[model samples]
Target: MRFSRVVEASGAVAATRSRTRKTAELGGLLDDATAEEIPTVVAWLSGVIPQGRLGVGWRSLTSLTPTPSESPSLTVAGVDDLFVRLAAAGGPGSVALRQGLLTELFGSATESEQDFLRRLMTGELRQGALAGVMVDAIAKASGQPLDLVRRAHMLTGSLPETASLAVHGGAQALAGVGLQVGRAVAPMLATPADSLADAVAALGPDLVVDFKLDGARIQVHRRDDEIAVYTRSLRDITAAVPDLVEVVRGLPCRTVILDGETLTLDADGRPRPFQDTMSRFGSSGELADDPNGLLRPFFFDCLHLDGIDLIDRPLSERLAALTTVAPGMRIPSVTNPTVAEAERHFDAALAAGHEGVMVKSLAGPYAAGRRGKAWQKVKPVHTIDLVVLGAEWGSGRRTGFLSNLHLGARDPDGGPPIMVGKTFKGLTDALLQWQTDEFGRHETHRDGHTVYLRPEIVVEIELDGVQRSSRYPGGVALRFARVVRYRPDKTVDEADTIDAIRALLP
Candidate 1:
């Protein structure tokens, strides 16, 4: 297949906003691909170039790159290849090559489309595009139902498997199996709930509440004595976490998959910052001598045990099976009738210095890759519903127009506006301009569309924690927060209160 075909498919996928349409188009492309060519094609399409991960990456910025005279054949390369190329072509010449590639093929694309391509190369396609969206596109192309494709994805770790299944067994084969939990399996992202009360209420009476630890979610897979620990995104960290490997190696079951979090606990047994735990993932040095460096696996859910698949099993059954394989790490359950008892558990978790707790519905089967109301999280931090007042222009591609935002909360006491923290992390270029214009129209004043807002619009904002700051009027500041979304339904007066902010402070 020609590179142009992949480019065309990319364009088609980019042009369509609907996930279903994108999935169908990608599916069609996959179906047409020859059986022998599937892996290579998948490799090419997924941009699995030689260097490692994909594309001309950030690492390329510091290194040297190939000259025009030495331009290698563009047959097919993985992410690692492009990244290395970019690294080698470190100066203006390499940048020109990347820009040339985007402009050469995707030049016909709309400005937004082109921006999307660039973002894709940079490894930040923040239009909320995910692997699942592409799965949907592949499903449509293969004439499979979207749900079937999604389920197949839960079963098979690779998109190529989904493609092969669709080509052979059709949609029916895709939907035949559900997600298997515990046996150290990967899970889809969990939707966060505000509190245990909120989670239990959403999940209902028959629920399991687990300690939401300060750690990283890990999928442990054991086949015989060999064990592999993969992060949620499937990055293998088995070698880096030697302790985890040893722990799993000692499991009772011969073959199993378990879902749990791994953390570095302080001497007092309190959870540490995520960075500390994540450091163990791929450290260049030897494992920390501290047993605290050990990845204490807490088995909350089980997908498989021995050779049997437990995807169809209820949460209760799965939990029971989970305990049999790994007893110490079993996530504790609370069956108190009232919400108040759950609150006591939440308080206990907080007292233990954990981030919060997770409440899972006991009767539901594990919904892999699904962010339904099945699991909920409760945190103590106060999330503000503020408005985007104005923005500063960003650098590089966002050279002009509003980039970072001036978010504010309406004074409940009818006082002047309170300035919260600013962030440039979440906004896409398109989102930047859209906000600029939107905030500009509601602009009380404007300096080239870096307009101040009416404070009428409200947005939900999440922060890691609150810190004391004299820089802003609220005497408190948001720590590392980005926009969740615009809460259009909320009015200025309806925003969270100062008391709420105080409650969130450390």
Candidate 2:
């Protein structure tokens, strides 16, 4: 298929607010795609690259200003092949090789295609073609069940592969996708509840309340002695987390898949700041021996234990299996607690230096990769991760630093990040200097007062709540939002969505 067709579909998807319209536009595009072109098309429309990061930052892309072609002739395969070559270019002279390839690709693209390529290469392609809508599109195009397509995508954790399967092998092939011992599946996520009482009321008394630690989410897979640890985004950090590997390996089960969190604890056994844990978790090499820096694993759910797959089973059954195998590593929890008892547990968790308590329904099955209402998190303060859109230059006492931050939330429909609010509060002098230096590296353009940036940095913001506003694109603005911390462990994709921000509205 032609690259222009995909670009047109993306534009169409972004131009509409109705999800059905967006799905229809994408479905039509997918229907015309050849089997060989399905993966690339699906990945692009889903706002990602099959080759992952190509190391092509905004600076490199902005340096090249190729004139647009008059007519469209570029094919999806041709563009994908160039991206592959660009991703592979990494040596003494690889920079220039990548530059040459990009220039060639962009030079052949038309004006609209050039804009699409620019946004895509910089991870700013927000065309409402998110994974959920694309899954529907795949089903619509291939005449398969939406449940089957969604299950295949969840099990494989690759939308492109799922799209290919739906288009080629049909429902039977999608049904064949199952949990693999060595592979990482998307971890189930929790929705937010206003309070512990609210959660108890919503989920009823048959609930399991566990302490929600302020740490990184990990999914561990063990087959005999071999062990693998993956982040919530499914990135493998097994080699960097050997301590965790040994812990999982010590389990009695021959084959198991466990979901949990990992973090370093202080001398007093309290969890340290999240940055310290992520620094070690995101490392590429073996870490030095540090007593406080050693990452410890805490299991919460068992997806697969021995020969039994517990994902389809209720949470009560899965928790039983998890306790049988990794009893000591289980997160501290209370089951079937009354509302008053759950409140006490929440208080205890807060007093113990944890973020909050997770109130989970006992009868809900593991809804992997989906943030359903079966699990709810209640915290004392509202904290959210948002993208750093731009920063204003400081004045007076804060002069010479980037003081005020422009924040944005991810659009659930896959459009560009929606500006929610800005804040100059909660920033220390040290943080000011750090952001000034850091934001410069990501600078796309600058005005007299602010430096606009690429939507790559994720910062955690603390807010009183959200209020409806006409100033922001999402029709809601954060109230008294302040910086909590910079989340280096998260990506724009993982940042809280506008729908989440809207949920906070009063």
Candidate 3:
């Protein structure tokens, strides 16, 4: 198909507010695409390349303002090949090569196509239809069950390939996609409950309350001597932590995909700060040679063991299978505890310097990537990780420091974050100094006392509750919001979203 068709469909999808209309538009595009073009079409609509980052910067795209053609001439295959070349161009004089290719590609595109390409290349395509909506569109177009497609997408961890399968091979093809040992399935998520008593009342007496550690969520996959560890976002970090690889290798099974948390602990066996855990994943992680700095894994749920996939089984069955393999590494939990017993357990977890307790339903299937009432997390305070949109300058005692942070919740649609509220309430002098130094590096614009940021920082905020509001794009505001700690471990994508914030509304 011609690339203009996609540009037009993108514009139509963005223009409509109705979910039905957006799905229909996206379905129409998918219906018209061939089997070979499905990957490119899906990737473009999702606002990413199949090859991942191509090292193309905003300057490279904006500087070359080439003239556009009167009509569309580029095919989907031609555009896909150009991106492949762009990703391949690197090291020594590759800059000019990328520029020449982009120039030619843009010069051949129409005005509308050029605009779409610019947004797609720069990762700024804010179309209302994100991955969730696009999955619905694919299901709509292919006449398949939404749940089946969603599960396939989640397990495969590739919407582009899922689209191709649904389009060409139908529901039977989707049924074939299962949890692979080496590949990371999207982790099952939990929704916040009012309290432990409320969660027990709702989820029933057979609840298993496990300690929720304030550490990095890691999904470890081991096959023979080889092992791969992925973060919440499914980015591989096997190269950084060799010690973790050795730990998972000791499991009884030859092939196992285990989901759990990893953290560095003090000499007393208390968990360290989350920042220290995350430091072992990013840059400078390989050089971290502290004797106490070990990412201890506690297998909470095993998705796959040996040659069998356990995701289809209930939590009870999954836990049983986990016991057969790595019983000692399993997260500590109490089953069907009374109110007093649960409280004692919660207090014990707190005393151990952990975050809180995660109460889970024993009958629940894996339910990968779905956050519902099936699992409930209870923290000491109503704390959530929010993205920092901007901050204001401090005055008097706190002069020359960044204060009064503008906080936002992540949007579900992958657009700009929704502004819920702002807070400078719980920040200390040390935090103020840190924010002043770090935030300026991400500053986009500064006006008067406020300096706007690129929404890259995630800060943990404690709020009383949410109230309906006239201000804020989310149509709700956080009440009694205060800073807890800066969540350097979280990305803008991992922070609590606007929809999650609204769930606490009174």
Which structure among the candidates has the greatest lDDT?
2
* Alpha-carbon lDDT, every model: 0.64, 0.90, 0.86
Per-residue alpha-carbon lDDT of candidate 3 for residues 1-506, written as tens digits (9 for 90 to 100): 99988999999988876778888999999889887897789889987788788878877777878888998999999999998999999999998898889889999999999999888887667676677888998898789999889989999888898998898889999999998878888888888878989888887777789999888888999889989999887889998877788888777878989899998898899998776787788754454567678788887998888899889888888898989998899887888898788888899999999988999889888888777678999888898889999999988888889999898998776667899998889888878988899997777789989999877789999889999998998999999999878876566767888989888887
> Which structure is stronger by lDDT: 1 or 2?
2
Candidate that would win on TM-score: 2
List model 2 lDDT by residue over 1-506, tens digit each.
Answer: 89999999989998998999999998999889998898899998877899998978877887889999999999999999998899899979998898899889989999999999988887778888878898999999999999999999999999999998998899899999889998999889899897888899999778899999988999999998889999988989899898898888889899999999998999898999887888887587475477888898888999999988899899999999999999999998999999989989999989889999999999999998898899999989989999999999989999899999999999877767999999999998878988988898888899899999988899999999999999999999999999988987677888998988998777
Q: Which parts of model 3 are misplaced by more than 4 Å?
A: 284-287, 396-401, 428-443, 486-494
Candidate 3, number of clashes: 0
Distance (Å) between predicted and true CA of 318, model 2?
A: 1.2
Candidate 1 accuracy as TM-score: 0.64
Ranking by TM-score: 2, 3, 1
Local lDDT at 425 for model 1: 67
